[model samples]
Target: MRRLLPVAFIVFGVISGVQCGFGLNVTVSSFTKSITSSIGNGINLVVKANASIKIAADDDNSGTIRALIAVSNNVTTPLNRLLGSILAAATAENVNSDELFVNIFSLVAETRPALDAASNAASDLQKTTKEYLYQTLSGNLTELSTILTNLTDGLDYLHLQVYQAANEEYPVTSKNITIFINSTVIADITMPLEAIQNYLTHVASVITVIASERTQVIKYLTQMNETISNGLRNIQNSASGFNRTVIDAYHRIMAQQVNTFKNINQTYAAIVSRASSYNGGDISNLTMFLSDLVAANASFLQFVSLSTNYTMEQINPVLQDRIAAATKTLTRVARFIANQSAINISQHANQCAQRFMQKLQQNPVVITRLSRCIQQDSNALQPTVTFVQYQMDLVRSAASSIANQMSKVCQRNTGACARAYFAALPDHSQVIQNKISVIAGVVSNDEHVVTGRIINCLYGTGADIIENALLMTKKFNRCMLVGP
Candidate 1:
């Protein structure tokens, strides 16, 4: 019995030691699990915090980036609009200049010499009519009428000089020059400019008709004047010789003829002065129109340059810089959050590991080994964090670099647009410039020729011939009405 009791006590002692070891091991395991759970919770909180920060950053920046983009679009839209409008206007002006150039070319080639011929014909008719009238003031009225009519007919036909010259230079039926004087060009400018030519032609016709009859009719007027004078003198000398009715009639006719002659002479002088002034005004207006075209071309070029500058120098930088700045800010904020989260997680892991090691002193070997492992994990996390940080830096750098690249692309596109615009412009712009210069030179040369010929002819010798012819027609008609 005594021996059995000792065995039972020894057995109880052994079981107690085993239970204590098991309890200690369970406590260490539970503590280690709690530490691990705490580290996991800390890591989860850091991840949540990082996610929340990113969401907040996106919210903060998106509106600003969008607004800036909107503003950039708004600013650049007008540049495009202005470019389109300016190009349209330039094209319209170029068309107008081209039409004018053709008209001027036709004028210089055809209308000019014809005008000169008409003017010469007018001068010749005037001189010949004047000399015939002065020399044969007392000749037969019928014969004088026939001779003046023949001479004036030549002058009147010269009115066709402009039309003939235009037809010859740019044949209406033929191919080459006729194409330029189409309905559109003609309607826009040709009709108005050519109207002047027709008007001058009509004037020549009138001068010829009037000059042919002037001196011949004047002879009849002189005879009537002489007869009337004789009758009035006789009536005064002896009232008994003529009746009261005859005397009054003779006096009235004489007064009417004298007034008509004086009026005709005054009208001739006035017309000559007015015609010269009118032609000068027309020339001045044409030259001014050409000058305005030059000014418009210059303005077009200036506006194009202004639009290009606004796009490349102003709008492009503003857009690229703003977007890049927003991206950088977003990346920087995310990196900061990630780094902070990593730090907080690492700290939590280290603190939990330290607590776990402190509570596990009964299992020194296991505790030491576990602590070393936890530290190694923490140390390993540092490289992961560094790698993440490096990746974030790359993202940030890429955002900025992409923005810079976009800016370069924008600049390159802008340059390409400018080049395209210039390329498009040269077809009309260079041709228009060349046409304008040619027109100016031709206008200058032709102005002298036209002035020397047409205007001077109408004002100088032609006016005198027309006056005499008009007077003669009136006198012949009057003489027939009042029998000599």
Candidate 2:
């Protein structure tokens, strides 16, 4: 009876444990299915939400909008809580399983409209900012161009004035008033133009208002007007000064030229008078006398050769030497006469040579002639001395006239050179300065244009900024509606 009771009790306990395990297994399986379904639904919702948001952001799409709404409804607290409870019950022994449920629920909950709003806002801000930048840049660029143009014009005027001032053939005094007026105009215009350019370059970085920029542009225009006024004043002042200087210099130069001409004429008269006395009466008579002298010498030489009783040996050496000497003397006389004629024809050339040599003590043309005469008479006799002396005196007078004329020419050229130097000095200096200023202005204007173009390219043109903004907004809306 005791053994039967123990077996019965053991059998009862085993039956009870097996039945309980079966029932627990059924509950676990049901819970596992619920958790699995919830997890799958959560994952699907999350994917749809992200895809919808991404598509919306990427490209406007109606499907993305619908998907986003569906995702929001699917990730409700009731669904999330149900899945959380099942996951907790199924994975009582697994900490990771519980965490996974929490993570999925929180991720879906947090990632809804918050992320979408941020992305949409960022895109809208980008476009708005770019449009604003483009408008500002465009206005600034226009103003900068105007300023640069004014500056360039002013610089051109300055360049012209400098050119006129430096040029030699153009009488500086005669054109002095014009040059002064031009310079003053340039300076006046440049002052305002420079001010405008500087202001534009400096303020361009900081200015925001188109109206303010326009005002600045107006200011520059006013400055240009003022500059013109100032230029006129400067022109008047410079013209007066230039006119006085030019008139004074011109009178002085003319007086000196006249005096030089008078002296040259008197010197030439003296030469003609002296030559007349030497030749017998006048220039024509002198030429005839020279011809007679040549004939007489020829006749005398023939007579000496035929009438002399000297031996051929004695006459040969002396006569030949005399003939050679005579030939040299006559050749020198002919050369002297030719040079004197050349000098008489060109008084300016003679004056130039003489003036240059007066300070140097060396006359190249005179030296060359003298050298030739001496070289030609190298093997001459004493009987040729008179002719040589006469030719030397004639050459000396001709050389003197040449020297005098050369001196006058040198004086004239020196004065001209000095004037040219004085005129060119101011011009060269002004031209360089103007070029540098203009280049700087141009570079600054170029920078403005580049900045404006970049802004326009990145955003849109000033004319189309609003249109582009609306178009971008519409595109963003369509992208948000589509799923990725």
Candidate 3:
């Protein structure tokens, strides 16, 4: 039971951090310092208890308990020093969230050895015959459990502190909000589309070169190459056109909507500022303010509706078409491989198989170009995946902060009205994430099929030929047919 405490606290902290969108705050320094102290004290108690158990187990000639304590000591020294470093690093309130989680995670991982040793020691004492050994081990474990429970209490306090810290009201200004919507929201969304368009153009060029190679021995090789080449071009063109016609247009529409939203927010702020300066006897002024609030809310709702409808009607169908183009390409390549007659073209087929094997071994110009092209494609996409994920972290933080500010205004309204207004706001993070994932998935699936069916099949034919040339064609067909 005591051994499970660390894991539970670690999980609690992680879930709390995630729910807050992992934002940095100006009051987390004290909370980090407090938790670090608790973990340090817990580590010391564990080390002491472990040393006492080792001495007693050695006296009783219990090899199992002695070995456990030795293992525990090996990790204890490093854990102690790392905790000191964490204490030193928490000099400011706005400590990096990633660094704090990493340090906390390190403490949990290193402390696992002591927890496991205690658990095994308790179990071994259950079967011991000597009364002295049982008494010694049992007493120390009780003390250790007490210490762990104290640490658990500290962890609970720290978790609550973190939650409250993350929710502290921030002063939202027009400048900062405009910076967020324009840079973090709009730039993050469109940059990937641009990168992907460039990627498609380059891939099309490489595929065209590979498809133009004339086969000397294999008659069907030319046809299969043409099928793959044409399919890739279709995919490239589909995505390229979609980006120009749909995604670019959507980006412009979103930019216009954000500008409108910014204008409306400024109008609301002006109204509030003016109302605050008025005297209490101005009933007509108060009524005018209420009318302005209603108008602002209506305009905000209209903006949300326009953005949502534009995304659904303009963007979604083009995304589907891009995915469909990729799927169709993969199917055509697979069908071409499946339709080959292995029996009818025996003489030329054998020569063709031998040539394929030779090409893989000698690393000819075609094979070299193909390998480099595949590598280039992977390199292009790897960064997009990482960039999108990093941008999403910022997007989530912005969304949470914006929602917090909006909720304050909503509280002035009736419950049903507040719910309706809050529910209509766009989830920019989720929508963008879903769109990028779909595009990446299409490319990833196409890459898998090409590598497995075409590149790997050729390489396998080489290996099979070395073992038995007669079985090469059969194995090659089998490899191509199992395309993923």
* Top candidate (lDDT): 3
Number of backbone-clashing residue pairs for each candidate, in the order shown: 4, 23, 0
Question: Which scores greater on TM-score, model 1 or model 3?
Answer: 3
The regions of model 3 sitting more than 4 angstroms off are: 1-68, 71-93, 102-106, 109-114, 125-160, 163-167, 171-484
Model 1: weakest 10-residue lDDT segment is 1-10
Give the runs in model 1 whose Cα sits over 4 Å from its true position.
1-282, 346-484
Runs off by more than 4 Å, candidate 2: 1-423, 458-484
lDDT at residue 240 of model 1 (Cα atoms): 23
Taking the tens digit of each residue's C-alpha lDDT, what string does model 3 give over 99-204? 6645655664565455456445545534322333344444444443344343334333443444444444764233333322223332332233233223223322
Superposing every Cα of model 2 onto the true structure, what RMSD results? 46.5
* Model 1 C-alpha lDDT versus the unseen true structure: 0.29
Q: For model 3, what is the alpha-carbon lDDT of residue 155?
A: 33
> What TM-score number comes out for model 3?
0.22
